[model samples]
Target: MDKIDKQILAILQEDASTPVAEIAEKVNLSSTPCWRRIQKLEEDGVILRRVALLDADKLNVGVTVFVSIKTNQHNANWYSQFSNTVKLIPEVVEFYRMSGNIDYLLRVVVPNIAAYDAVYQKLTQSNALFDVNASFAMEQIKHTTALPLDYAGLN
Candidate 1:
């Protein structure tokens, strides 16, 4: 990708709904070229699916919980089963395999403590975990889906 592609990405990351003409104007290109660039970005997988950001408080799922999981079973079959079980829980919005003492981490969102407990119960019932720890966030200081484009080394 070139500088124009990076500029397009930076703009789209802020608001995918921005008009092609506006993007072209900002990037000093014609509308057709800007539109084609966006299409190319999509076809090349540089630009994934666009989505609307939702307000958790308004949705009644304000509470955020980070769960750290350490498992005794590290085999492929065990991981497959664990991943499948985790995927079934709607509250688990993010899941990651960590490099530190924690084997896996999950970010869960719920309405309240009781709702979180229900999700916790579901997670444990499906698979056996060696150790599970959960930490609740009192406040969300910053949350964003936008990625930094400077890291791409575009001029």
Candidate 2:
């Protein structure tokens, strides 16, 4: 992607609802070419999908918890089963496999401590986890979905 494409992606990351004409004007491009670039980006899988950002507080799910999981089983079948189980739980928004003391990490959102406990119980019941640790987030200082574009060498 060129500089203009990077600019387009930056703008879209901030607000996907921005009109194509407005983005085109800001990026110093006519409407047609800007629109074409956006289409190409989507086709190339650069622009995955647009989504509405919801307020967690307003939704009554402000509490955020980070869960660390360690398991003795590292087989592919066990991993697939664990992943499928986690996917079924709506409270688990993000899950990652890391290299360290913890085998997996999960970001869970819930209404309160009770709800989080319920999720924890559900998870433990679904799969065998050797160790599980949870930490509550006291404050969310900064949160964003925007990816850094400088790494793309478009700056």
Candidate 3:
């Protein structure tokens, strides 16, 4: 990838619906070449599927909760079952296995505290957890899907 490719990515990150001609003009390339670059980026898996950003408040799911989980069971079978259970839950937007004291971290969004409690109850019933902690987010200062292009090296 080169500087132009990085520029193209940055522009697409801002708005994936940006027309090829518009992106091409910004990157100082013709439409064909710019389109080709985008195709190559997709083929290389650098360009993942584009999606729309939705407003949580407008959807009435403004509550954000960070859930930290600790498990005594560290085997593959336990992990597989727990992962599957979490995957089936719509409120769990993001889930990750961590390298710290917590075994897993989940970012959940819901309409209210009662909804979160229901999710928590479901999780506890599905599996045996050593500990489960949830922290509610009071405010969101910054939120963006755009990643930095500086580390792309070519940029």
* Tens digit of per-residue lDDT, candidate 2, span 1-155: 88999999999999999999999999999999999999999999999999999999999999999999999999999899999999999999999999989999999999999999999999899888999999999999999999999877545
Error of 3 at 20 (Å): 0.5
Error of 3 at 70 (Å): 0.5
Provide the lDDT at 101 for model 2. Answer: 93
Model 3 TM-score is: 0.97
Show the colliding residue pairs in model 3. Answer: none
Pairs in clash, predicted candidate 1: none
Which pairs clash inside model 2? Answer: none
Against the correct fold, how does model 2 do in TM-score?
Answer: 0.97
lDDT tens per residue, model 3, 5-89: 9999999999999999999999999999999999999999999899999999999999999999999999999999999999999
What global local distance difference test value does model 1 have? 0.93
Instruction: Tell me each candidate's TM-score.
Output: 0.95, 0.97, 0.97
Instruction: Give the distance in Å from residue 153's predicted Cα in candidate 1 to where it truly belongs.
Output: 5.7
Q: Per-residue lDDT of 1-155 in model 1, one digit per residue for the tens?
A: 88999999999988999999999999999999999999999998888899888898999999999999998888999899999989989999999999989999999999999999999898888888999999999988988898887777555
Backbone clash count for every predicted candidate, in the order shown:
0, 0, 0
Q: What is the C-alpha lDDT of each candidate?
A: 0.93, 0.96, 0.96
Among these predictions, the greatest lDDT belongs to 2
